[model samples]
Target: MERRKFLKDVLKAGVGVTAGLTVGSALSFASQGKIELPLPYVKLDPKKVADRAYDGYYEHECAYGVFNAVIGELQRKVGGPYLGIPTLMFWYGGGGAAGWGTLCGTLNAAGAIFNLTCKQKDFKAMIDTLYEWYQTTPLPTYIPCKGNWCKQPFPKGVSHSPLCHVSVQRWCKNASVYFGRPILYNSKERSERCARLSATVAAKVVEMLNDYHFGNFKPHKVKGSQKTKMDCRLCHEVTMKELS
Candidate 1:
């Protein structure tokens, strides 16, 4: 146990040093004041982004999976200062903020990337479209591992809400699997489903980024009346318009 603790401490120290170096590099560049927030982004291939995110899910779960996939690809393609980003910090977003199951981690990661690379004026609009897309689309449509990791038949479902628990419970219901506990949540089939979903989200984010990079991106506009079917809208219509 002592040895194990010592090794754990050593690992933590190493991680701290590495994180410090990366952040130091980024800050050094920042001190020059030559760079700005929402860093440079070149066009990235959606297919490659999907592939990386699919594999990344196994290593770091959902949020960091998508975050690292995009940022890591950026570092590979455009190495100037992209290497300085501390991508591992995104791991906290996994399991909907460490298992509380709040917002879907993939969407959270996508939003972060959009803010990181796109203009602030445009990022929220991009997030709006992406959230709506996630809410409506049948997910796990981009399966990278067909018969290999997912030997058993897996199912898909549409998540009407962007909350991770809701999205995952929807899939669990469709797949006829239990939705509680780590053992069931970490089941091979469900895990693979999320991996594919991460890939799908990552690919979509990359495509959107590519479009923005090339001046082809457009934000979706949903009419206020069509936003939801709840009766609260009757009382909140004016409030909604003000917010919008």
Candidate 2:
């Protein structure tokens, strides 16, 4: 059978047998049989990587105040997959409340990209690239309290919430394992390295989002009347102080 036909047959059979086999197990069986699997667009290569990352950067912090200014420019000029709920949720959950800080955002962003360029042959490369990217980017400034717009308020009547703290710690631990390296805390060298790494990844993601040929989805601008640009400086600075 042709490669595509063989893959289709395997997928159909996998679906039929799902009752008896876990998804991962079915996939593993398919893999051993030489059946191909789909992959996300951004995981395809360096170009796609740049595109997806860019989309994440543009949508950072749910900054709806400046959505019109940024979204149109990104769509028209950057010309990639418009940010969607899955992408936003990943960032908000992992980057915002999940407590991974910037590291989660970066990894989640990479995962989104991975979904795009995924192919059976590319799985190893995709996993490796994700780890490689994380090893270079490291962690960013973290705030334990909820004073900033990006974070949720501490649970009602509690001075401190162990759940929130635990969540962030878990994210960091997972990230370190994914990258196979110790997580880097904010420092002069590490900070600069993370900033540069983020920019590089963001640029790659944007390119992939555009190149994948996915239909355009309307950008969901954040709801607010504020007329200011949101930046890392505002969020990190204030939140760090609150945590301290």
Number of the top TM-score candidate:
1
Give Cα distance to truth, residue 66, candidate 1, Å: 0.5
Per candidate, the number of residue pairs that clash is 0, 25
- For all predictions, the C-alpha RMSD in Å is 10.6, 18.4
lDDT of 1 by residue, 157-240 (tens): 888778898888878777764333333566777788889998999999998888878877787644334565223432355575
Identify the candidate with maximal lDDT. 1
Stretches of model 1 off by over 4 angstroms after superposition: 1-35, 145-147, 150-153, 177-184, 221-244
User: What's the C-alpha lDDT at position 210 in model 1?
Assistant: 88
Cα-based lDDT at residue 2, candidate 1: 71
- The TM-scores of all predictions, comma-separated, are 0.74, 0.31
